[model samples]
Target chain A: MNPEKVNLEQKLSRFDEHWSPKVVGELNGQHVKLVKLLGEFVWHHHDEEDELFLVVGGRFRMEYRDREEWIEPGEFVVVPRGVEHRPVAEEEAHVMLFEPASTVNTGSAGGGMTVADLDRI
Target chain B: MNPEKVNLEQKLSRFDEHWSPKVVGELNGQHVKLVKLLGEFVWHHHDEEDELFLVVGGRFRMEYRDREEWIEPGEFVVVPRGVEHRPVAEEEAHVMLFEPASTVNTGSAGGGMTVADLDRI
Candidate 1:
């Protein structure tokens, strides 16, 4: 397979769905995804893998069961495996997420928030 | 472990070495590292894993055995497993790299470019 090369701006132009992640690249057995988010995401956690949320642009807030924190552009937070957390944004936020190749955005929640299949960009 | 939350700006400030990558974060069993590079890096390849080069702040050029590519800020290129390649930048460039937790910066090449150990920020 020819290796895929993508730019943040280029990937951002390919999709408009909020909360749903579009796969940008893959390294080893992990996937890199970009998501445009607004409002709030359901509280969920991946039972077997850690999730990384890297804010590419705009502000992001992640609220955990016991604490909440704010992340800005260039900052990132890793939600440990099996930790329930919700992500919310005051406005449209562009972010990159890193997780295992088979991880679901909503993890085991399987709700409206769960994206059925991963879209490759 | 209080899951570490680091901004790219904060991590960049803690190290000034060129070519040597400082580990910023880890997800699953992989590590995320930041490196400031100038001039050229030796031709090398990881026999067991693919490597990701995300240009965080400058331009990068990677030359492979038969092909080459240029990447700019906000852009990323993945060098596939076992592809011998060399990375070079005319001016100082800042980038973030993703690889397996134990993969060295220089892969199997044990040289000065091979950082002794991953430095956690």
Candidate 2:
């Protein structure tokens, strides 16, 4: 095992993609990913996996079917499995996600924005 | 679903006990815990669970038999299963943990510091 810790900021700095998530750390079959969000992401739902989003900087608005909740920096929200949701950000938002390693960025919704394979930073 | 975001700083402000992790969120059978650390914790290893420690504030030192790693704010470390490790902090450190819900703080080594049940904040 590598003795060095994974510096999240250093990892985040290497990528500039708006929706692409870069894997930084993993444990217990879960992956910790860093991503920057701008505009609205695809509305999707993971049938078997739940997702956790932590805002590191800026604000993120989680758009559910019924309502929308804004998450400020240092706040987090958990989207349960099978719950359709979308992340919308007016400005660039630095975020961290904790979810299963098998989770796809677009979930079951296959589209142009779907990222089947994610990059590791 | 609550549709409300969990403010990490707000939850952190509610607890002052070190080593005792309070559950702030849960998804996919995994719990997101917040804890404060000061001084050295027990040397133990999880048999089936891998622990993820993300330093939210201050510095945290992970002690292993081979080497020591210092995790700074916005950094994280993954301690794999069956690896003996301990956390040492000279000053107060705020940390977030992402792991399975069944993971015990003391791992398989039970003692006074073992928290069988965690409180939600």
Candidate 3:
């Protein structure tokens, strides 16, 4: 087994595209992904998987059905399964996502923003 | 459902004890824990669960069976199940752990450093 250390900053630097998630690491059937966000993401809900969003840089507002939460650097927000939410960022935001390997970016509301093939950074 | 944002820095500030882990959040049956580590830790290995060590502050060296890996801030190391490892920190190090809710601090080598009841920050 390769016990290499995964550097978040280095992996994040490898990509520059927004909304496209690049896999940084994997453990226990979960994929740790790095993504750049700008503007607004589509409202979607995952029926069977919860998603964790950890802000690496910048800030973003996560809008839920009943309320909105601001996630800044070093902060994280967990969107539970089956809950509708949208992430909006004024500036470029770097985020690390932890979820099951089978989880899709657009969830059940898959459309053009849906990324089927994620590149491993 | 409480869709609260977890501030890692704030959660880490709430505890100062070394080797003790405080839960910050939970998702998909896994607990996100913040722990302060100082000095050397006991060598142990989980029989059935893999562990993720994400360095939030300071630095530490993870001693594995064959080699030692130095983990610094913004770097993460994953220890696979049943792999013998020990974590050592020259100075105070803050880390965020992601593992199953039932994961024990001491793993199979339970001793005085073993913490059973982890406080939720």
The candidate maximizing lDDT is 3
How is the predicted docking of candidate 2 categorized under the CAPRI scheme?
Answer: medium
DockQ of 1: 0.74
Overall local distance difference test of candidate 3:
0.92
Question: What are the clashing pairs of model 2?
Answer: none
Model 2, B50-103: lDDT tens digits are 889989889989999898989999888888989899999999999999989999
lDDT tens digits, residue span A13-81, model 3? 888889999988887888889999999999999999999999989999999878898999999998899
Q: How far in Å is the alpha carbon of B90 misplaced in model 3?
A: 0.9
| Docking level of model 1 | medium
Which window of ten consecutive residues has the lowest lDDT sum in model 1 chain A? A1-10
Candidate achieving the largest TM-score: 3
Estimate, for each residue in A1-121, the C-alpha lDDT of model 1 and write its tens digit.
4455688998899988899999898888899999999999988878999999889888888888878888898888888898898899999999998889889888878788888788988
Residue A2 accuracy (lDDT) in model 3: 47
Off by over 4 Å in 2: none
TM-score of 1: 0.96
Writing each residue's lDDT as its tens digit, candidate 3 over B1-121 gives 8588998988887878999999988888888899999999999999988899999999999998789989999999989889999999999999999898989999999999999999987
When just chain B is superposed on the true chain B, each candidate scores a TM-score of 0.93, 0.97, 0.97
Candidate 1 Cα RMSD after full superposition onto the native fold (Å): 1.4
